[model samples]
Target chain A: MKSSRGLRLGTTLFSFTNEFHARQYSTEQLILKVAELGLGPGLEIVGFQSFRDYPEISDKFAEDLKELLSSCKLEPSCLAINADINIGKDRTLTVDELVVYHEAQIRAAAKLGFPVARCQFAAGPEVIRRLVPLAERLNVKLGLEIHAPEAVDSPLVLSYREMYVKVNSPYLGFIPDFGASAKALPPSFLAHFRKEGVPEKIVCVAEEVWATAEGNFGARLSEYHRRARQTGAAEADIHKLNMLFAMLSKQKPSAWIEIMPQVVHVHGKFYEFDKDGNEAAISYAELLPVFRDGGYKGFISSEWEGTAFTDDNGFEAVQAHHALCRRILARA
Target chain B: MLQTKLIAENGLRATSTGFDVEVRLPWYRGLPLSTVEIGDVVLNGEAINPASVSIEVNGKTRLPGDLATLYDERWYVLDSAMLHVSHSELKRGEQYDVAVSVNLRPPYIPGLTWAVKDAKRLTANS
Candidate 1:
């Protein structure tokens, strides 16, 4: 039997993708602290404005990181490829240029004891085709992220999978973000809740929120708290109060693992933990059993999202999640 | 902190000694990307974009001055100093505009990458 080799619970510096002022936590702090916390299943390293500069990844920095992780015994989770594709200057990437970017990531990952390098907006399958040979040469996963507003059945899936089948390559794959699948929900889908006909004011803020931004309300429980001061309802237990109602409202478990085999690492996301240290919104009782059944075995790092921790308790929250996720994955 | 966007909607190509500048609408204008030409020299560029203004990135400062001569059109890129624009000027909220200059690169390369020589916070203003 292929036992689940899941590596659980690590942090993404939290502030990196979530905001622009990401330097509140330094690279050294994020790395050394994760090791200090003993949350070293693997560390997702951001090689951009937070730690390094553009066009070039730092060689000296990479060597220092290698020494740190080796002493601390942490494997690299992944490397986020930075693309400042905004407006004003040129932001498009040629395949060759992308290879150069990928080369930097590959070299960084190898030095830090990683076989997979994760990229954000991976253009298309042709880019993957070009990257597979490079990844084969370097031995890495040139990952494209399947995000929300796009599903497993979407055209993007067809492209990635078709490239895999046609080229029959293993170097190219995907990082199936659970948050994206969690985003696939209907507007009128919340009517079937057990706590139905309750106060509309409870989930009122959340409802207004999912309407404008990304639709996957289950993954975005934290965003509600951000706008709550403006909504005249910002207070304790505000976001989770809305989330508990939202989770119970789901009619089905949802098709989350459709892009799994391609996934190298997971953003082990959760909002609540029970007396026994289990997630509240998600049914791991059912989900872990599913992974066991499907032979799904790999890295699962906890990304404790939600506003409960704040800046002061970020470390505490991460430690708690690290312990809880370790316990869960140990059972598997 | 100020930004401007232009597109070379038809096509743009420049020589070591000569360059042309044109402004066109963006792809949102239902024009083609092939028509959009951004000027880029590997490490730097000199743009006589307008009649009297000259913008030059000689691998250091984004120096803007009065237009002088033919060197106005020729771009200079040092061995490792590539010049690129990180984004376009999405004026207000609309998403289209055309620009001209040999300074434009096709979304592949960044304009300028730099390191601070001696960066520190001032205790107080001089």
Candidate 2:
């Protein structure tokens, strides 16, 4: 039965990073592939990766993109923008300079017909506050990506929330990456390390540490290092293990309820699917209901990051993820 | 790290001064040149002098060490920076072992620098 939920499915081209870097598909071709594969009625793109001259869209490019999307029957979900506050080698970008940088990209996003521009938090609430007027004028929402290593109540996000309350603008919000609420480290991620010669004993210990270890990230890092060293793990392997802490989040899924109203978009982050077609790392079973219950009427961009660890083309991974979401939402 | 994809396929070519091997940014997004640090270039088990190695991208060329302050130049994700070694030992149609390392310090991700290394054996083209 078709569910009446406002949630919609889509794909971000970041999922095809491997194919794009391998020169197998151009930006246009990837968009077409997403349409052909039934991966989207909604599409998202990272500006720098998809455009030759980002933050500066030509009239020709804009017209062509609009036509392409019209013909392909796809909606421009969000434009992922970079807030390069540290572009300078010797000094970080000042708030005014950062605003200028972000303004150009936000204008480009508006021109290209993206309703939302996914932003980074490198720039503080001051920079975001400075951009709010432009965002309101252009009707483009700036959604800060709450990726791994950060959660809804994280200090930085909490600061943004404080600002949001004072401002009270619908244009300012969060884009939660489900990876930040993962239930386990991706199995493929661990398997890749093992294949690289990390000992099985060390892998098991790392898994245990990831699952049951308490304390803040720094304390956990020290503990994992101490334990892995006891198992004779190489320094290189231990260094690789650091990604577990950085990429996968330990935040509980229910934590998302705190900011669900401010969520303008969702990064449906997934690494691998088990034989039963469930995500191996993140618990979509636990995440989807939060959005459903919280009245999130936005696009959930299926972001497959499996290509980061494996050579898979990721087409099937996105397909599987979409299927899983549909199955879960059918019962939501 | 996508280290294997760091070296472009069949990208070794003999230049007027020496030979140029095409090296790519392993990251998914384009970054300013200021953030990229080009490291060692070794051939046939002999490491080239660091001063003799230069990277050419976006129509401009700079020595490996000079890239640290070049904030204006950008390395497109799809593009490759040519590692030009000013040596006369390379010959056309000869297979040689090539190794390259590059470090990326993304400004947003504080206190993290991703190191990528690749070694490929390919015949040089004149």
Fill in the DockQ of model 1.
0.03
Give TM-scores for every candidate, taking all chains together and pairing residue i with residue i: 0.55, 0.96
| Residue lDDT tens for model 1, A32-64 | 777787776567655542343422446676688
lDDT of 2 at A19: 90
Best by TM-score: 2
Q: Which residue runs does candidate 2 get wrong by more than 4 Å?
A: A199-201, A232-234
Error of 2 at A86 (Å): 2.1
Q: What TM-score results for chain B in every one of the models?
A: 0.20, 0.93
For candidate 1, write residues B1-126 as lDDT tens digits: 001112222222232333322222211111112212334321122323333322332333232322112121222111111122322222232222222332232121233221111111111101
* Candidate that would win on DockQ: 2
Q: How many residue pairs clash in model 2? A: 0
User: Model 1, residue A312: what's the lDDT?
Assistant: 30
Native contacts retained by model 2, as a fraction? 0.59
